[model samples]
Target: MKIGKVLIANRGEIALRIHRACQEMGIRTVAVHSTADAAAMHVRLADESVCIGPPPARESYLNVAAILSAAAITGADAIHPGYGFLSENANFAEMVEAHGFVFIGPRPEHIRMMGDKIAAKDAMRRLGVPLVPGSLGALASLEEARQVAAEVMYPVLIKAAAGGGGRGMKVAQDESGLEEAWRVARTEAKAAFGDDAVYLEKYLDRPRHIELQVLADTHGHVVHFGERDCSLQRRHQKLVEEAGSPVLDAAQRDALGAQVTRALKQLGYRNAGTLEFLWQDGQFAFIEMNTRLQVEHPVTEMVCGIDLVKEQLRVAAGERLGYGQSEIRFQGHAIECRITAENPDTFLPSPGRVTTYHAPGGLGVRVDSALYSGYAVPPHYDSLIAKLVVHGGTRAEAIARLRRSLAEMVVDGIETTLPLHLAIMEDPEFQAGDYTIHWLEQFVARRNPAR
Candidate 1:
């Protein structure tokens, strides 16, 4: 079951991150990329590289046939689909396994189960995970939606069953708005995901976005790496994340962790996964589960001192988790700032040459990026160019370190979110960790009233 070589089916920082982990584990890496990313850092550092297609992602990164062909050409024993792209694709996972390469993720059935939001919620409910009160499944009609909204009370959320990144989601302030919200949500869902199926959930007014990171092995051993507070987001896309949330004490962490691990074990889940929740009034309601590594996984690693990517590799190779939940411990606090190639104020994509690149360096600072001097930031992929991670003895210390690191870090010749992150670090509310899922949007509006 030893994985000698792995094919990285991704790009940018995450692809480089997986390559580094494979290198550390004495596994050779095959980096697959589009023609536009032939010069990417991961492609350059890999033992072998393959060009799958043109600049557009549809022709390249998501091209399953080309990626599988590359893996075959490179003799890869496994395929590691990093956080995005084909990571949560159940069909791709099945194809990878069908092609005789280990897919370093959850089983296809698990991915398929969680890919559908309604099915995932039902499964979690059966496994003792708390869910927000709403419709039992996709609403069959506007009347059904109205009934569910009334049952859950007004101010409900209409969400796409196959949606993420805030797409296909609308808020109905009251019964008067439910019809339009439902129509808009379904339309958006169909246009975006090719599926118009939408559901309802009781909207918690001031819930914090907290997620539990869990790793399960094929041997039935599961462990949790605590929780991350990702409430600092704009439009449902997280900008900053903190490990071991400020409001959650050790007791709270243990209780949630125990519940998550137990539930995942009962479901027979394997590999890396994250269970997202809305925490309000000292209670957690399961929202959804991401069946892949998260973008902010480094923060969890910093606090738990576990190499999640390596664990994924091991589990995919049919190895058992050597330790149990009790053995896993949370250490110092960690924070991660997702630095994207976008305007700080307008938040528009800024893809161009990176004339100068310098990442922060210190005892507890880590930069996961693929950017370099003279590199062209591709316009075809995700705007995220780098992730700045910092660890410290406490949340206060982590903020201080993050501020210092942000000052030292530099990405020139293109607009980046560095300024925005610096502003966040300086804000008192952010420093105090007195924020919720709606905090960032309000903060941004306050900063720029014109927008």
Candidate 2:
């Protein structure tokens, strides 16, 4: 494979992460930044930089033409979309290819199929992948949804087919809830993703949000690295993640991993992708596929000792995968806590300047962030400030290390979820890995007694 220049089409920590990988590969990098990220760490460290557009995302990171122009002007051969923005936008992927730049991810068709939740579920079902019982297609009317819910049984989950990041998701326990859920879900879906299409599924109560990380090349070779348990969450957002989910046994892991691998190979998947599953009562059901790298990727990387971003670059360059499933091995356990700028309880975006910043450092501790002392936390983008990842020989050790790391981490001048994370570490349910998706809600309730 010919190694050349690559363009990073995102900002902040992820952009820097890709840049570091490209640098290691001795490849030149072009960092595209919005007006808000002009002085970001990624922009300053890149081999070259381009101002894509203004502070807003639609006019900037999601602007296909501007990103293509940047790649063309910078002489970049590939464009790497780091996780969000237009990362999984099939239209943008096609545009990149049309402009003679390789997209460092799955093919355009895969993105389109997975971008729509309903379509992705259909594809999974076709490949014999386990999916929750619910409407096979979009519910055209409230009556239709009610009928499907009756068959699949409630409480059913109403999700925007074209939405992600927990933006357009709700629970409808019965027929009455289904009617109002459809309208509200569609409204939020259209506003967030410009697509109001939605689908319903049986919402498994107290399911662990486990996901398998898979890598594939154009050579038809695909393998699951491992699974990450992201059950500890708030409002459908993951707060803490760990590799080799304590919830799954060896036989269960192999079964779920093999199923996901078969589905990916059948679909001709390539590059880096994640198959999300809702695990409950020892049964795994496919939720969706993220056709881009994930935020919790570092946890898997830490355990597997692999540079996923570098592999993405290699695969996009038409190179075959370096390691097969048998060659990959999962070592010790690893955990990652997403330190974000938000109200501990309300979970509202709390962006502001970092009057003082201190990132924890020591053995077995890794901090992936773009924050620095006195740097302003721009309100123009996601609130994620840093990821505190730690590895240990055992799950208990990893938890202890994570607790210490979070305590040592300091980011002043903005209210963050640090306190909440601390509380989580101290929670007995969390310490024992006995919590589920709704654990945070229950924990908060206990933190504040009834008025």
Candidate 3:
């Protein structure tokens, strides 16, 4: 069940990352692209290229039929849906399997179960994972919502059953505000996810985002990489990420990792995935599970010294887990900064031609980017231009190395978040690791009063 030729069903740096992994494994790769991405870095490096559709993502990246057609024509035996696009779509995964191609991800049923927040919670609970105090299931009506809120106490978070990225989430302080919160959350959920099903949960005042990276194989073996601290984010979008959270003790980290991997192993899960948790008061609460490779996977890979993308390919080919949990080792602390094409002050997308794109070079520094000197940063896609990752023997050394690497990085002709990252690297609170998810927005407000 070896995968011979692989088709990449994504664009940009992730595709290039997967391409390099396949190259290293001596496997052929087929790059699928839209008209706008024909000149993308991944397209240039692939063994073969296929144009799926026009510029828009719906007609290109998300068009399952066209992607399958491209894979079929290219004779690719497997498809790697890199991070976004159709990566977590259960229908797309089933379609790929239906077309006789191995989907380089978890099973379709696993994807579907985790897609809904309610079902995912139940699954996690059954596996002995601690969850945030919330509704037993999705609320059906305003009355149900009220009942759950009463039982769970006040200051409950209304969340979309099928939502992520803070889109369909609201916090209600008391019963008086529950009705409006429910309505608003439902509307947002419908508009954003096409699913108006909402749930109730207890809201934590201050919580840090910690996620455990897990990998499984068809042979029933599972392994967990140490967690990543993604507390630095805006509107639920992660910016800077680091391995070895400053707050968690060694015992706590190992316990949480063991809990997550054991859960996945019990559920018959396979492939790469992430179990996100809210860390508060020395307790870990389950948030949600991401059934795809993460953008911050580089940080985990840097510290663990395992190529996650290659492991996905190998697992999809029905191979056994190459390395056991004891064989895996964490060498150093790693940090990653997502450098985006945006205004440093306003945080708005600034897409245009990259006049000068010079990546930094030094020890413990790695840059994953699709940008070139003349490559035009497309407005229709994510504004992330590159990811700067650094590793060191200690967290302090990692931070200092990341600062040096960020200082050396150069991207001209388009405004970028480079200035913002630079300021963060020098900030006292950030250096002290005393920030949470809400810290970035507050920092920006303080830096730019009257904005």
Candidate 4:
């Protein structure tokens, strides 16, 4: 089950991260790209490169057939589908396995179950995981939606059953707002995921987003690398992520981590995944499980001293998880600020060639990027072009380190969200770790009134 070559079916920083991991493991790498990503850093660095399709993601990154063909032609034994695109596609995973190539991710059934919100919640509920009170399945109609809202109380959330990432989600403050929310959620769900099925959930006001990083192998061994506080988000997209939540103590952290590990092992999940939760008042309510490596994985890696992608490679290659629960250790605090190619004030995508770029240095500062001075930020993809992660002995020290590193980071010739990140680093509530999911939106509205 040894994988000698890995075909990375992604672009940008994550692809580069995978390439580096493969190279360090003495594995050859192949990069698949779109026309727009012809000059992507990952492609330039990979041992072999292939043009998958056009600039559009549907024909390029999301084209599972093209990705498989690239792997087949390039003689790669494994394919790493990074987060987003087809990373969570169950059919794609099945196809990769059918084609005799290992998909460096969870089992196909695991991906399928987690891709559906209703199914994922039902499974978690059966595992005795804490869930926000709501329907156990998709709402039958507006009548069912109202009934569930009555049972769950007001301020219920209507969420799409098939996809996540903030799409097809609407909150109804009361019964009067239920019908419109349901309709709008269905419409958005169909447009985004091609699935109009929606579910209801009790909406917790300003709950903090917490996720545990779980690693497992085919040997039925699973372990957790503590928790990450991803409360600093904008419109459900994480902007700032920190390891070792400031709120949870040792007892709570261990209990929750053990709970997640047990649940994942029960399902026989493999490779790396994340169990997201809504935390408030020391209680955790299950959100949804992400069946792929998260964009904020660097924080967990920095704190735990684990190369998660390397572990994923081993797990997918049928090797046992060599470390037990106690073997994993958490070090000092770490924080990650996602640097996107967007207007700082308006948050609009600003894709163009970077004229000048300089990375921050010194101890505990790591930059995962695909950007160079001449690299062009493509307009056809996600705005996130780089991630700036910093580590320190204490949370306060991490914050201080992040501020200094951010100040030293320079990306010229295009607007970026660096200004917003700078503002967040200086925010009082942010520094105190007293904010919630909705805090970022309010913070921006108050200060950046024009946008």
**List of clashing residue pairs for candidate 2:** none
Scored against the true structure, residue 445 in model 2 reaches a CA lDDT of 78
Where model 2 places Cα greater than 4 Å from the true spot, the runs are 448-451
Ranking by lDDT: 1, 4, 3, 2
Q: Spell out the clash pairs found in candidate 1.
A: none
Considering every candidate listed, which one attains the maximal lDDT? 1
Candidate 1, residues 99-183, lDDT tens digits: the string is 9999999999999999999999999999999999999899899999999998889899999999988999999999999999999
RMSD of each: 0.7, 1.5, 1.0, 0.9
lDDT scores for all predictions? Answer: 0.95, 0.89, 0.92, 0.93
Off by over 4 Å in 3: none
What digit string (tens of lDDT, one per residue) describes model 2 on residues 1-451?
5769999999989999999999999999999999888778999999999998999998998888898998998899898999988888899999998888898999999999998889999999999998988889888887788888898898998889887778888888877788788888989999998988888889888888999999999999999889999988877778889998988776787788888888789899999999998989888889899999999999999999999999998899899987778898888999998989998877789988889999988888999999887788899888998989999998899888888988898999999998888888877778888988888778877875661
Model 3, 199-309: lDDT tens per residue?
999988888999999999998999998889999998889999998787887789789878888889899998999999998888899989999999999999999988999
Stretch of 10 with least lDDT, candidate 1: 322-331
For residues 1-451, what per-residue lDDT tens digits would candidate 4 score against the true structure? 8999999989899999999999999999999999999999999999999999999999999998899999999999999999998999999999999999999999999999998888999999988889888998998899999988999899999999996789999999999899999999999999998999999999999799999999899999999999999998888899999998988888999999888889888988899999999998889999899999999999999998899999999999999988799988889999999999999888888999999999999999999999999898989999998899999999999999999988999999889998889889998888998888899899989888776
Q: lDDT of model 3 at residue 340?
A: 93
TM-score of each: 0.99, 0.97, 0.98, 0.99
Query: In angstroms, what RMSD does candidate 4 have relative to the true structure?
Result: 0.9
Candidate scoring better on TM-score of 2 and 4: 4
Error of 3 at 252 (Å): 1.1
Which candidate leads the pack in TM-score? 1
